[model samples]
Target: ATGNYLDDLSAESHVILTNAKAEVEILKAQVGDYLQFIRNGYFCLDSKSWEQGNRVYNRTVTLRDSWAKMKQKMGL
Candidate 1:
């Protein structure tokens, strides 16, 4: 009877440990998903910054072109 009780206790302990391990695995997966989300946000922001820089570059090129045309008309 004592041996049977010990076996029951061991089985219960195994079930508890297995459940804890599963919980930890779930948390790890959540953390991984959060990291990916943060990385995606960073990349999106970087893309916006690049787009703004390109727009500024295009504006500068347009102004330069206009200046050159004005100079040509004045024969300078």
Candidate 2:
């Protein structure tokens, strides 16, 4: 989804991710806290949903695919 406010009004661009094996410490994350989801990217906890007792994270930046770069270097 896009991070642009005008492009994603209604928060409809949000995607719900399921992590059944996530660490317990994730539950302690506060609103506005930036978190890195391993191979995924950086995301911030949504404040509005946090106030409503929901865990909605908005992706901020995506992780660069180093593997893709390696593939390109190998001309594959």
Candidate 3:
């Protein structure tokens, strides 16, 4: 879950996440490739979409949380 990722991040983790946008792109491609070889009849594939949505959601929450904390600290 996106909340889990946010809660799991530490200062060191945030440093690595500076390039999370790029890393998520790589992850998405890998996911797609994994899906390609599967022709299972019951694979709704909605889970794949959900994973991508989580990545974007994480990206947004990460930045937005940073901004909110900064604004609060600045009394803005």
Candidate 4:
């Protein structure tokens, strides 16, 4: 999906999901603060956006889906 498989720019699709809600503490997060979003992934406050007064978060890592992998291995 988001990963590029070829050199063509149209080969990859970019999706932006915005306006998801978060805990109140997220409002107080400073730049470079690391956060674990439940069932989602780890994220960090985007320093550049913070400097611009925007509460932007960049996903650092995706949560591992062991169950999904197991199911795939089993041909489910």
lDDT of 2 by residue, 14-42 (tens): 56667646788989999878999888889
| C-alpha TM-score for every candidate | 0.18, 0.72, 0.21, 0.73
How high a TM-score does candidate 2 get?
0.72
TM-score of 4: 0.73
Taking the tens digit of each residue's C-alpha lDDT, what string does model 4 give over 22-53? Answer: 78988988887899988988989989878888
Lowest lDDT block of 10, candidate 3: 35-44
- What lDDT score belongs to each candidate, Candidate 1 first? 0.31, 0.84, 0.39, 0.80
Which candidate, 2 or 3, has the higher lDDT? 2
Ranking 1 against 3 by TM-score, winner? 3
Find the candidate with the highest TM-score and give its number: 4
Model 1: what TM-score? 0.18
The ten-residue window of minimal lDDT in model 1 covers 54-63
lDDT for 45 (candidate 2) = 92
**Which stretches in model 2 have alpha-carbon errors above 4 Å?**
1-13
Candidate 1 local lDDT, 1-76, one digit each (tens): 4667765564433221122122343333321132122211211122343446521101111112577799999999
Cα distance off (Å), candidate 2, residue 4 = 10
